[model samples]
Target: MKLVLACTAVVLLLSAVELARPMRRRKNSIAQIYRAANITPVPEQILQVNFGGIKVTPGLEVAPEDAVDLPTIGFDFIPGCYYTFLAYNSNYSISFLSPSIVGLYVNLNGDMLADSSAIATWLGPSPSPGTGINRYILNVYKQSGLIDTTDEQLLSYQIDRLRFPIDDFVATYGLSGPVAGTFFLSQYPVFASEDCL
Candidate 1:
């Protein structure tokens, strides 16, 4: 009986370790992907991004059109504090390691239900042919206070929304705590581009 009990205990211990492996791998994978892309560090809170009637998890492959509409960003907001939702494409340029901004929307009143401020309108992923997987990151930044933006500036942003320096923008707006974020992968249809072949 003693030997049988000892074997059972060992089996349970091994089973617990096995179950924990995936969770640890998941955490590491999230960080690894974010770091690899050279985007801002991964936020502590992970936002749930639902696109095209499906949840867009990290590293999930998606077609460009599947992300034509804005994904539903799910996160718990802190009342009285402002937040900014920005989408970035880390592989937009043909040159290696070039990144650009795809969208920018600010929740001035700290409410997602109302019409939020859209500094730069949403432009879905349109990676050029032959460019491999492009990582589209949706970052939720908690602002220190109300952000000031002029109509002329907003118009200019729409005109030129590429090669955005994310760090500079964060400092300019006093943005803190990407409080939450999520990212997905998208690529152009290689088959459609015979020239790319």
Candidate 2:
């Protein structure tokens, strides 16, 4: 009888250990992708980015113009904590940062674009042909205070929206916790007929 009880306890312990393995592996896998992309060292809190009928997910392939409109960025809001939202193409030109939107709330009344001013006017994604899949990442950063920077400061290379100093910008403004992030892959159709374009 004692042997039977001991065997049962060992079986339960082994099962519990096995169950934990998958969770740990999944967390590590997610973080590794972020690190591999040089986007961040840790896994970001997931957020929803919906473009019309399509929803953005990590590494999901999407058509170019299908992602033309601004996605609806949704995430849980911390009370009184200001936020900064930005999106960039990590694959193209290193980092093609769109305008940064600052000082937003869960309820921005009606128009999110109107409620929040984009330091640089918002530009939609337009990956040039043959660029392959461009990873478009959108991150919502929790700001400690209102960001004190302008469009020029954010995009120093005014000639084109490339080589954005995202790391420097984050450090300079003391921005932390990209609280939430979501990304999708896009590329222009290289072989499509003229009508398709």
Task: Report lDDT per candidate.
Answer: 0.77, 0.64
Candidate 2 lowest-lDDT run of ten: 102-111
Q: Candidate 2 on 1-197: residue-level lDDT in tens?
A: 99999999999999999999988886677677777666663535666777789987777888876776666777776765667666777667333443223112221222254455455444656676666777777777667676644545654433345655667757766667677776777777676678987
RMSD of each: 5.1, 5.7
TM-score of candidate 1 relative to the true fold: 0.75
How high is the lDDT of residue 119 in model 2? 55
* lDDT of each residue in 61-119, candidate 1, tens digit only: 88888888866777878778889888888778555445677888875555362367888
Q: What TM-score would candidate 2 get against the native?
A: 0.67
lDDT of 1 at 85: 87
lDDT of 2: 0.64
